[model samples]
Target: MAEGVGRGEILLRPLPCRAPPPDGAPVTGTLRLLLGDQLTRSITALDGLDPANDVVVMAEVQAEASYVRHHKQKIAFLFSAMRHFAAALEAEGVRVDYVRHDAPGNPGSLDGVVAAAVARHGPAHLVMTEPGEWRVRQMMEEWRETLPVPVHIRPDTRFVASHDDFADWARGRRQFRMEFFYREMRRKTGLLMADDAPAGGQWNFDAENRKRLPEGERLPDRRRFPPDAVTREVIALVERSFPDHFGTLEGFGWGVTREDALAALDDFIAYGLPRFGDYQDAMKAGADFLFHGLISPYLNAGLLTPLEVCRRAEAAWAEGHAPLNAVEGFIRQIIGWREFVRGLYWHEMPDYAATNHFDAHRPLPAFYWTGETDMACLAAVVDVTRRTAYAHHIQRLMVTGNFALLAGIAPREIEEWYLAVYADAYEWVELPNVHGM
Candidate 1:
């Protein structure tokens, strides 16, 4: 996808095509619950899965999409991705009981949906990857009330940092900042490292990466994924379900499968990475992407792994296709800042969400929703966000996010706004970026 997620060609795929298990497969295995973000099959929760006896439950209930009044594009992207993942599992001989948003008498919550699945399948137990959001995890904690079986929540291994590992790194530190943490991550992953040293003898080159897009420099044509049958259907459903949502449902181009995500990565490295380090922090009036990789959504989703993305950048540097600054900066975000944020998020929560170090108290202005502000930069960023559900990091941090903080808007309100609008926002990732900042 473009920065946020930019252009890509839509590779349409229907639900799984493989035949189901034997006509009378025994219902002996525990039911596996899959959330919208946990779309990969490599999840620990699915290890040793039994296609003959176990059932996989994936749902698109109204409760989630409506929980924050998410952008119509975000809702459509997740639902469409979930459907494709479920279908892929069914093709692999796993029995998947997918509940649609429009399913009759849908209970609207994960607990409610899982309980319904239990009644239909009569599984002995439930297995799930730990959810990303604290609020959702709180609900999972009380599942015994709704489910007849015991529930087991496994750690999500998609991230390089586990809860314990992150806590260990942060323990007994008097003053915490990302630079030291990032250095340790570079050592831990061996990314852009040589013989126990950073490849460039520097931890970060961000200071040198502040150049603006030069005048008359043209941007690469963005990769746009035209919606196919499945995506078109999802777009229509989102339009009907979220008529009042903030952003437009038209021009939806996010990649919903593993192949599409890989294609997105290739496109970025080919055209974006060379210039990314030079102008990463620069902003143009109407350019939403510039040289940034819009692969964060794919990375956050199970479609692509963070470590792998970093390795790709490292490889680009090693092969001399990209400068060390460019490669190191990109890798640092994936392995360093991203991991640090998630670690801080888990270590500091269920109190993190309530953090307001500045004690700010104000409302997010109406301009955020309408992109009608007088500031040229802000209005342009908001206009792009309204159309694409994305704005580059500068637009987010220096424009809208900065305005909210300077105006003393409540953290919770702004957090909700970010969560509602970005296609890549999940509480685990979005809350830390918002509240911790």
Candidate 2:
């Protein structure tokens, strides 16, 4: 029964294998699990990848996609980006077990996928970088007792700030504001400050960034990364699968590959950075993107690290090509407020989601789906969101989210819409920003 017919001959074995005894089974190999957001090359789990023994398991689980009625483009972005990453790993001769959404007996969630992969591979240990969402982390921990392998969740190396470091800075603080944290970050990273002090004797140049669109000030032509074959396929699949979902795919111009994301970052540095600070908080009626860096999609999807972005802004500052406020405001967003909000999210999650300060429980307006709002600003942002699946911070915070907050839209409902629409609206960042900011 064990003998093969010939060299290179195909062999079919019985499907069922006897389950080994729970306590006596030996741990044989290592399994590294990567969630969708952990798509960057700088992750720690890939440091010691051995093509012969190690298996990298990445899955497109239904739990993630169905958590909210995700936008057609958002789903396409994550799945398409993940597939691209998997292909890159395979090109590097790295062994990868990618679980597609349509695979038979597919796990409905990440937990189920991890269990199946561990059982199939019979690995000794499970390695992964820490997940951003608390719920995901809890499920992952629960899998440790259920799975036969020891799970080791390592700190994500993508962020410049550490949990312990951020906690220490926040210790004994009264009100946890992003401004104070931004200053500390400026000192720690030496990003846009002179001798641990904010440049130009001001911590924030937000006043400079709040200029509304002048009556005749016309915006230059916006930049975009045209869709490639993979993205086009993804758009078609999304249109077919999620016909009822909001958002248009006709103008779906996003960077699907890492190289494209880098090009986008460079373009923003050269063109967008000069006016980014000036218009960071401004909103215009028909302008989709007004002097804003459209790099959030890259930053949120793990294609670009926050540290690298801050460094780029710093380089611009050193060259005196951009003003202190512009460079500083942009850098603080990457290094300061982003991390501060993330820390707050982790510290108060599962409870924070339930907070309704204004007791808003209204359904998201129907206009959010169709971009049919009376206000010209909402119309513009929503139209852009529908077409491109991308919106700058002002559009998100002031135009869309601000309207939701002012109109007393339910936090949960608003969160769902934001999560569904924007390519960069992941739970970790979107939740707090929607809830409080």
The numbered model that scores best in lDDT is 1
Q: What overall lDDT, based on C-alpha atoms, would model 2 receive against the true structure?
A: 0.75
lDDT score for residue 84 of model 2: 86
Each model's C-alpha lDDT? 0.79, 0.75
Candidate 1 C-alpha lDDT tens digits along 1-437: 11011101221122222233354663246678888888788987787688876777777877778877788888888787777777788789987777777766567676677766777666666888987777778788889666667778889999887989888888999966888989888888888888898887888999879997899998987776788787888888889888998899778888888788889999999899988999999998767799989888777778889888888888898899999989988988888878888888888889888889899989888988897778998799888888888778888888888888888999999998988888887777778888756
Candidate 2 lDDT, 1-437, residue by residue in tens? 00000000111121232233266554335677877787788787776666666777887776787667677777777777877887898788866777766656776677677777776777667888888777778877887788776787888778766887778877898888888887887888777777866778888887787766677875656566777776776677667766777677776667777887888888888888887887778776667787777888778778888888888888987898787788988987888778888877876778999999999878888889898868887888888888878888867887788888888899999887887888787778888998877
Off by over 4 Å in 1: 1-28
Q: Kindly report which residue stretches of model 2 are placed more than 4 angstroms away from their true locations once superposed.
A: 1-28, 215-218
Model 2, C-alpha of 74: deviation from truth (Å)? 1.2
Q: Which ten residues in a row have the lowest lDDT in candidate 2?
A: 1-10
Residue-level lDDT for 264 in candidate 1: 91
**TM-score, every prediction:** 0.92, 0.89
